[model samples]
Target chain A: MSVTAPKGFKASGVAAGLKTSGNLDVALLLNDGPDATAAGVFTANRVKAAPVLWSQQVLKGRAVRAVVLNAGGANACTGPAGFQDTHRTAEHVAAKLGGMGPGQVAVCSTGLIGERLPMANLLSGVDSAVRKLERTGGDDAALAIMTTDTRPKTTVVEGDGWTVGGMAKGAGMLAPAMATMLCVITTDASAGGDALHEALTQACRVTFDRLDSDGCMSTNDTVLLLASGASGVEPTQEELTEAVTKACHDLAQQLLDDAEGHTKKITIEVVGAADEQDAVEVARSIARNNLVKCALFGNDPNWGRILAAVGTTSAQFESDELNVAINGVWVCRGGAAAEDRSKVDLSGENISIVVDLNAGKQTATVWTNDLSHAYVHENSAYSS
Target chain B: MSVTAPKGFKASGVAAGLKTSGNLDVALLLNDGPDATAAGVFTANRVKAAPVLWSQQVLKGRAVRAVVLNAGGANACTGPAGFQDTHRTAEHVAAKLGGMGPGQVAVCSTGLIGERLPMANLLSGVDSAVRKLERTGGDDAALAIMTTDTRPKTTVVEGDGWTVGGMAKGAGMLAPAMATMLCVITTDASAGGDALHEALTQACRVTFDRLDSDGCMSTNDTVLLLASGASGVEPTQEELTEAVTKACHDLAQQLLDDAEGHTKKITIEVVGAADEQDAVEVARSIARNNLVKCALFGNDPNWGRILAAVGTTSAQFESDELNVAINGVWVCRGGAAAEDRSKVDLSGENISIVVDLNAGKQTATVWTNDLSHAYVHENSAYSS
Candidate 1:
């Protein structure tokens, strides 16, 4: 029970024939609410998918009652016809839910871009999903939104009397701003649309925004949060933000662990920067360097490549004063070799690289995965 | 004859103990010139190598007699000791040349970083190279600078009476501002340091600066141009720029063809941009996209990935007005699927992708290589 872990929410998934494998590919999440309030975040890619455009318009109302998602055709770069398809999808969801307008329904799509959806099959699937909706169908909904992901990701955080829970699906095309994913979070706590939006923004900034798996942004990335007010618990903004952040963090970690063909989950911590933005820039540069990623994959403590990557950024730092540590061993100190690199073990699945700028007292962390043969194979052989 | 094709130049290559394989690892190029006017360009990365620092200082005087380049130890990130090593190498070269000072000798090094060079072996290798220098030794000089390069890159362009000849060595870690390579070009044309610098800068701006193989800038990229005035020909700046550009273009193409573990050489041309910088930014973004590289490697006409990369840039363009052609087939027109993707064949070693922003008249081109499993294997298996 991910999104359904909260009260007054029901969800279900059904096979839509959109996926050739005949897997469950359509998910419907409904808020049977005393109050229907929602907030959303989307991909920064300007060439957004049809569903993303539709959802952005729906979010303007901030009173969504349901969300419909699919994992087959991206419905991106398909021109006006694709936008109509997304509008039809939302209209179908709203009509099946009874007494709701199309503006109260959000739409999301994933998979190959520049393709149209099978409208007949998708509409029938939505009908099936709505009829089968149950309080405990969150797992099925989670499984339905997967494209390349190997497993369903879900997390729950308990409040005083309410609960926040979320589900996400992503395996490739992950990068900063947000991963190529579709996530829906639901809570029974009472909150206004502005508060929910604020909490979600704050939660996503430090959680999902720091993950740069493949350094590729997607055309259809969306995260949604809904409130039902069934628990009648009105937590303060701080409490709501804390619980939402916890749920987002848990889901983000799941995405990282399940990233496509990744052998290691690397966390880069950048410290001693002039400001947080500087630290973030430095960490992102290191995270995206293919040479550094390859060296880490080979378990080589190649501090030189790391330093070279750091030098590419405009972040404030003296080259000779930089320090880098791998697994608690300072392999590079003052821009030169300090400790024996052999002492740093990288055979484990989890790796930590710490870069100290020695500039000031601001810090940031970015997460990434190694570039492996499997990564190259999976990305090249398939068209995901 | 490469660099020696120009009059008043002699070069030699000698094997040193620095390379365990006993291959030629040191090269010496001496200008037997009546006039020694030179201009140079180094890596833009702030964390530069010891050789780059020394070479920059030498170039300040705008006069140089000889250049000593070695492969097998980059002499980078070794702190003050590395600087001392580079200084000592220059001084030794100057001493061997009789009346020249250390400031007239430029030094270049390539290979593994973050380590000290074998001073005794390197000095001995330098002495041997100086003694063996001959007018026809340019080919051997090119061979000595190989790190992962499979062949020597040399080119010569004939002017009215003078000539411009160059040799370059690089296999990986290629990116803009400049590639991770060292180059030396010699000319017999009569030109001052200011004119030589202007010509070199203009030529490189359109040639070597546009090749981005792996998106990794080096700490030791250097390009030097030396004028000897041996032919007694003073060509116009336009003529000099054209010949130098031709040599740089030929050498850059050779580097792209020999890039480490590459299967296909890709040229991305971005047209209809608001300005040249916008075009260049768009082209480089597409050139460095690993997903785009992988798709091309697998012979998949995945135009969506190319479009997605273009959307990441701030180049002025309406998403719906964008167009892309792969191998002369317009797969994406008006930002949507127009022609059949199957029409585009990617089975050859050379691939061309054209992106039309439909925004302005400016255009730019960038060259790159496809990301392959061999790239991962080579980079991960070795410490380079």
Candidate 2:
């Protein structure tokens, strides 16, 4: 019960001919509410997909009755024809849902980019999904959005008398400013569009925006939050933001766990920074260092590579005043070898690397995965 | 003949016990000149090695008579003891050269970081190298400076009565602002320190500075140019710069050919940019993109990945007006699929990707390599 955990929401998933595997490739989420308030965030990549451009326009109207998402082809780089395909998809969804205006429906697509979607099959899938929409169809909707993901990611957070539910799908191309992923959230609390956008912006800033899987941004990243004020529970703005943050954090962790071809889930925690930005910059530099990632995969506590990565950042830290600890072992102190490297055990899936810049007191954490042979194989063997 | 191809230079290579394999790990290059004029460039990495710091100080003295390079250990992240080891090595080289000042001797070290050098073996090897130095020892000196490089990189360019010759060694951790490699160039032209410095700077700005293999900057990258003034020919600054640039370009190409685990040497050329910096920024963004590299390794002309990389830069270009070609096949035109991707051939070892911004008249190019399974294997299986 991801999106359906909230009140006055229905969802369904159905198979379309868009994916050659004949798997469920289309999903629809409907908001049957007295209040239809929504907010969204999109990829920062300048070359965005047609669906992303369409969804941005829909959200600007400050009302969204439903969402239509597919996992077969990313309608990107197909020129104006691609934008027309997205418009037609939204219109088809609106017609199937009792002939509502196309502006009330948002669309999203994820798969191989620079390809057009099969309109006839997608329209038929949307018709079937509208007919099958039910309160308990959220699980099927979660499964329909998966491309390379091995499992579905969903979470629910309970408030005093309301609930927030969300689902996300991503496997690779995961980096800051949003990964190559799609997400949808539903809340049954009495909040306006401003409150929902504020909560989502704040939550994603700390969660999805800190995940740097490969340091490659995507062109079709999207996250949507729909509030259907059917629970009659008017929670405070702070309360709503807190619950949304928790839900986003849970979903982000799930994405990290299922990252493609990853054996080790690494967490780089930077402390004693001059400011939060400095901490983030330093952490990101370490997260994106392929040499450091390879060393972690080999279970070698090579603090020298980590220090070299730190040096690439313009963060405030003296080279001779820095220290690093891996899995509770201080392998390096004051920018040089201190404790024996053999004391650090990296034979686990969860590895923690802590960097202490003996500067002011500011901290940040970034999540990433170790680079491995499987990562190269998965990325090279397949086009996606 | 590489460094010793000039008129007044003698060099030798000797095995040092610092390397467990007992390979030729120590090299000495002496400028037996009536006038010694030199210039040097080091790594841009803020966390520099002990040898780099020592060499930077020595270059400021406006006279460098000799250079001692070792390939067994980097002598980096080893704290004050590492600096002392470098100082001691320089002093020993000076003493072996008949009591010359230690400040006139420069040092370079490459290999695994965070390890102390075996001073006794290194000094003994230095003594042997000084005694064995000859005008025909350039090939041995080139061999001594190699860590994982399979072949020696050397080139010669003739300029009227003067000549410029150079040698380089590097296999990985190659990026802009200097690769992890070390290079030494010798010139037999009559020039002062200022002219040599200006020519050397201009030569490197367009050659070594454009080769980015793995995007990992090393803490120990050094390139030195020494003029012996033995040719007795005063060439114009343009002539000197032209000759030095040719030698550097040849050596840079050699480094690219020998990049570790690379199946394809890629050249990303950006044209029609608003300025040179924009072209370089766009080219580097595509060069450093792992997705693009992986796609190339798989022999797939995935132009969407290339377009996405181009979008990541803040270069001057309209999304709809941008174009890209893979090996002369216009795979993407006007930001959409154009020529059949099947027409593009990627079976060769050399690949060229051109991105046209259609925004201006400036252009630039960056060199990189495809990511392969061997890359992951080499980086993971070895400590370096």
Candidate 3:
């Protein structure tokens, strides 16, 4: 099985005795002192986890030899003690690999927020993870990082003398520019750290930030990149851009597919807005509507709810400039509803709504799901 | 049942077949002028209903004689046709009463949005309602305006030379005060429409506007003030001020209690902020969090989720200056957390979170409820 997959990369995933189900929970990836460069992104949440804080500080130097991660408990709200656990884990991995210092390892943790990590279990887990590192280990590592995701998410985009392989973990609390996605990308491409960071940020702008389903931000969210220069080829900017976009697109879909209790991924397209931001806000406002989500779950054709949601936005458009189309059928025009609403079929798993502001040429698309009883059930009974 | 609840006011509630359920759905109130004065408010939604548009036009003049209301379908998004519906409903009641034109009769309707009024049923309802009008008819009228509301809402406050009585109808999509309240306030204090409109607007600033739970803005929200000059002694402005404040406080609670799927009313208090809006945005963000609501429903002491929500707002508080108190117990301070988390007891129904920004003296309070499966059930099942 490809664990640290992508050409010229080494990865490992181990049980670590952290999960009650004995599932794999700790993973490691090493770049092996390559000319390849690294880049990353982390949650905007102020309540950063111990691992997130530690990794962010290390990444400031922009050079890392390896990446280490664990799941099951987020080292958030754990104070100084949690920070120590993260440093020790990185140290253990570095000592075992013998090619870098603790500062050269980027660390990330995901899962239940505000919980303390079991240092006793993690200490041994890090050592075993380093010992088990191997090529094609990306599959196991992807599985190891998951919390509530129904399946593992892994993608690899091959380039000349380099490869960009990534994995992600997330489901609910998703919205645009990205939800609580904890992503890791590994490439043997020889690019500078600053350049890599810049590229990753650009890719995240549209791919990850546009998904907001539950509208909650997680404390343990993170994204990291590690490069091993074994590929012996420096790729052009164009090649890197194309590869990164493809990888981001793949990982985003993976996250969407695993959205908790979601049976359908509806795309809300807001067209003819004053600008792109207005379209985004209007679509997002509708996407975040609980009533509309519930209506969708029930498979009811409630177009009024859609208009009401759009109306609540503080955006530039009002009732006068609004025109609405659902599934390519115009239901409202010139500030009034279309006389022909019966032509639209809203009772389906896939629902599409287009709001034309008649103000600008820019448009925005937002992905969301209907509110379902299963969502309520999953969240309500989750802790118990 | 003591429906003409306000002193110096006369009201009547009667059967209106506009609703297919054969329930009473029309209400009338008469204020023969005031010894003191009257006031009014309206919804902030840009997509105003026919009645809202008409009532707003009338508000430009300020003096109101009577208010006529019915509940079956909200005449919103009906375009030119919708305005005609509001006109005919008022005209029917005015002709039967033999006192004024349609312009003098304020109108309100609440039920399903986007649907047109059943003219045949409405015309008959208006005739029967006029014949049944009486001074003691406030409670039935309260019941008539309810759509998803489980019960009618009515409150009364007595003033010198006039008695202020009020009735409101809204259970969903309520975050009133920038309007969004379908309310009828009656008094015999003898005031003109301009003064009344000013007071009504002022009172609503804190009362109706502060009660945002669902975040949805209704197209048909309106609040009408009728002055019946039965009271000979004119009350002072100070007296009206006190009455309006008290009315708002009580009604805000009523709206909170009536919020959808709310088994528990959670108050989020953000204190020590730089300003009121900053505190308000922080509290509002937390109140609007679906994950936080679900966690509350599960009785999970998820303060981390609470802080995460606060960080997302534009509030002027930093993580380091944050101090969190759940159910009156301080659990976090500075940039880390304390062991007092055990003090939070969400084991019961009501949950209260006190976040002391410790950064400023500003404060704001927001009310919300836990997300429950029953809420999903109710909204998903309802149509028209």
Top DockQ model: 1
Residues A52-159 of candidate 1 have per-residue lDDT tens digits of 989999998889999999998889999898899999999999988997999999999999988788999999999999999999999999999998899999999999
B1-384: candidate 3 lDDT, tens digit per residue: 322665555567766676677777888776544432335577777677788888777666665666888887777777788889888877887788776677677888887667778888778877777677767777777877777777777777878645777778777777664665587776666566565666777777666766667666787778776666676645666676677566656666777788778777888888999998888888878888877788778777677777777767767766766777878777776645665566678887678888887778998787777888878888877773
Q: Is candidate 1 or candidate 2 better by DockQ?
A: 1
Q: Grade the docking of candidate 2.
A: medium
Q: Encode model 3's per-residue lDDT on A1-384: one tens digit a residue.
A: 322555567788899877777999998887765453677777787667788789888888888878888888777777777789899988887888896899888888876656678888988888888888877678888889887788888888888767788888888767533324688877777778876877787677667766777777777677676666667667777777777777877888778777888866778888888888898899888888888888777766566777778777777876766777777787777666674667877656677877887777898887778777777767765544
| Model 3 alpha-carbon drift over 4 Å, by segment | A1-3, A176-179, A339-348, B1-3, B34-38, B191-198, B339-343
In candidate 2, which residue ranges exceed 4 Å CA deviation?
Answer: A178-180, B178-180
Clashes of each: 0, 0, 46
TM-score of chain B of 2: 0.98
- Candidate 2 lDDT over B163-194, as tens digits, reads 89889998888884853379999988988888
List the candidate numbers ranked by DockQ, top first. Answer: 1, 2, 3
Q: Which residue ranges in model 1 land beyond 4 Å of their true spot?
A: A178-180, B178-180
Lowest lDDT 10-residue stretch of candidate 1 chain A: A172-181
Compute the lDDT of residue A343 as modeled in candidate 1. Answer: 92
Error of 1 at A282 (Å): 0.8
Cα-based RMSD of candidate 3: 2.5
